[model samples]
Target: MIHDQSMQRRRSRIRGLFGVTAPTDAPADAHTPVEGERARLLDAIRDFLLGNNLDISAANLLAAHTAFSGGNPRLRRRIGERIAAGEAISQFWLDQQLRDDGKSDPATHYEDMAVRLQSSVERFRDTTSSARNAVVSYGRDIASQVETLAREEPAATSLLREKSQGMAETARTFEMRLLRAEREAQSLREELARARRDATIDPLTQLPNRRGFEAVFEEEFRMARSNVEAMCVAFCDIDRFKCINDSFGHDTGDRVIVAVGELLKTMGTGSCHAARHGGEEFVMIFRGFTTEQARERIDAMRIALGKRRFVQESTGDVIGKVSFSAGVADVFAFPDRRNALRAADEALYRAKEAGRDRVEIAG
Candidate 1:
């Protein structure tokens, strides 16, 4: 059931990306014209790329086809704008925008281990303390009985010695049990922490994935509401990212993504959080920034990215520049976190509609 739901969601996203509507009851043949048009556009894009010696990556081809099919007016307009800005449009340039994996940090692992060990130690200490107390009480009772036996019957001294030995042996056994429990708990805690970190991070980009972002968002939302402070959420999508993956290959795409991730990490500090939302989209949280301030910061990043150039190291070919569109929203202005995210997403759509490499603030 979960798999089916996931597949349906994937199909929905594909349809949305390609500007296809949900299926209707019409006969399959009724969609032939549309499919044929898409095919023709795809062929045309292929031919154009080949004629111009452009890199023919799948993402680039798809972007070109989508633009030619008139399915995505925003993408078409973005292409035109790039040309107008005196930037050379090529497969290499497009490939420079779309992009990935990784080992766990030793520091984080050690820190988690330390915390687990500390908790285990504390637990063991408590258990040992309780056991010690029990032993002390037992010893007191044994001593009292021995004293009585000594007074009532001096001949029972040998039996009293056996009883004291038994009590001492029991205390030793309890201490061992506590030590074993501590070891087991420590092992379990380490595994749990490692699993949690793996689940929350994107293996490819080494950035916090969607799940992690949601957790952070919820926490920030709660804090903002409690403090009555302003917070902003911004959604960013790389422009023509598909083209980058198509042109240079997935490896190059991965490099591009890593570069972007590093840049985001640098930008996301001082009460701000940045995460890879999925694919070529990223989301950021700004704790103290208003919508306008968030927009300015995002726009600045967009400009910075656009100005940076990527190069194919092996061939030393310039890959041109990459850009992104962003939308920023003031979370406090919305009724809930969900509403704030929706508002930011709508604003991002507007930014893309206006042009790529720009930022829009939700009103």
Candidate 2:
């Protein structure tokens, strides 16, 4: 009851700030401005999530709630622009935007987990080392005392020596166990590191997944900012991918995905860093390249890729020519990295609208 009353008081203050007031005798069901706005926002968010066929997952709910409630002006603006520009708010795109804005933790979560695990391993190793040292020291002290006892008391020699030897064996056994445990801990630490790396890479493409790409981009973006360098990021998507899958089956789709992955991997060998952005889309970044230069390079790649013919391995029948469309944005053109990607995505939408199998530069 106290919390509800406090919340009501806060609402009243907010309403007063917005030039709204409740009458002295207003009914409980009265629709105040703040209450009405909240109701409308709730309705709008529901309509949006359901209408777009987006999952009702926690992240989506939080993002939508924050966006609709005007908590994040940039996210709200970006979502509005994408809608206005005829872009679908796909799950992948939403996840990308969330990651770009640092709202999502999926990308760096593995690293965070690894850090904690590594710290634990280090602590365990330290504890084991201390225990091992203590046992060894204890065993040496026992042996030294037993030898002195043997020298001083010849009659008690047999019993003292036996007890000392038993203690020495126990200490050795414990030390060996500790050593084995420490080795296992070290192996676990290495495995954790590998797990972190694996999490960031796409299994299908052996390319950096969205999270890994972000990690690379973050470093590059930071350096580009510090040195004031030219950089470009492009989004590449297969043209008529759905039609291909429907016509030829999903096996063909997987093959197409792999084929694109191989090309992007090859491109990654150059100055451009490439990644499979998810689904039929890939992302690439080029340093020391103007937006125009990047667009030309991407266009040439597209043309060359279009020239290649894809044949089904099993059927040996030629699948129709596979092609891709791309959108390039100058990293420096926008104030931040996310906006640049959004601009690139918008240009990609325009390219699709114009016709696929081409490259478009962001304005």
Candidate 3:
């Protein structure tokens, strides 16, 4: 009851501040000034609502509520008076939303998703390691028992032969167990490795998916966050990919994607990780280099991709050439990979917006 009363009191005060007095037995003309004030408040509210982020909106709303509660005694008195007169407060300022500024972009989503995938891979790794450990422990115990039996029964020749055969069987059993353990370990390693790779990489392009790029970004972020190491992240997408897909079949389009992936992988050989971020989008991370340096290096790859001739395997028809737009961000200045990822993404958007097949760096 107390909570409801408090909330009711709060709502009344909000309405009064908005110049909404209780509709009462008093003359209708009594609300003329209040109606005028309400119009002005609404105008101010609209202006405020137009330019707020969620955080700012929340802060301002709380401030408005607090001011309504304590700052205007007339408003407070009117609120109490309205409640006594049984007026219902109907309006609230909580539903307003500012425009989405896109602070949480696709790259951010990918990074979070990749982390979860990697954790699952790690669990697989740990489980496999435990199994290997158990196998080794059992093998060691059997080997110890076989050795002790051989040493204690050295004189009984036939018995000794039986012991020898027993020891050989034990050794073979141990070898088989060890071999199984090794194979299982290898399989587990491969499965976990594949899982980890799949988490971040696009299967088609073999490039880092958004998830993969995010992992690289985070690693770079941690590296930068810890030390003075520099990193560069680049966001790229095939130019006119949709047009190519539309003109040609999806199979040819897929071939182009695969070709680009192969070229990018070969081109990004040392200290660079490249991935298919999403759709036709690709991301690359270059370690130990300035954005300028990385740009120069990647520019060559861009040109190579642009100039490369791709023929439609079906008709042996020339598919013309492919090109890409790229945006590069450096960790030297930004330091945070998340910020760098965002920067690169924004730059890539700008590059695409300006013109295709060009490189743009984050300012």
TM-scores of the candidates are 0.59, 0.70, 0.50
For candidate 3, what is the lDDT?
0.60
Candidate 2 residue lDDT tens string, 34-123? 575556456546655765668999999988876656333335545655665556678898888777666322555556767888899889
Task: Please rank every candidate by lDDT, starting with the best.
Answer: 2, 1, 3
Candidates 2 and 3 compared by lDDT, better number? 2
Please give the lDDT score at residue 252 for candidate 3: 87
Cα miss at 66, model 3 (Å)? 33
lDDT of candidate 1 over 1-363, digit per residue (tens): 986664445433323332243422222333565575445445446544553356777766766664545323334444444543545556655554331101222333344666676577567666766765676677677778878887888798888778877886776677577666656766766676677667778777888877677788888888877887889998888888888888767677777888887778877675699987766778899997888887887777788788899876666667789888888888878655665775677577768777778898888
Candidate 3, 1-363: lDDT as tens digits: 986664444444444433354422222333565565445344333322332222345645543342232222112233333434565422332222111111212444455655665576556656655665665676566567656776786565456566556756665676566566656656755775665556555667756665566566667667655777677888777888878888888898888888778877885655687877555666788877788888887788888887789887888888898998888988556523444565676577567667878889888
What alpha-carbon RMSD in Å does predicted model 3 have with respect to the real structure? 16.5
Q: List the residue pairs that clash in candidate 3.
A: 207-275, 207-276, 208-275, 208-276, 210-277
Q: Note the clash tally of each candidate.
A: 10, 0, 5
Off by over 4 Å in 2: 1-57, 62-122, 147-158
> C-alpha displacement of 158 in model 3, angstroms?
26
Local error of candidate 2 at 272, Å?
1.5
Ordering by TM-score? 2, 1, 3
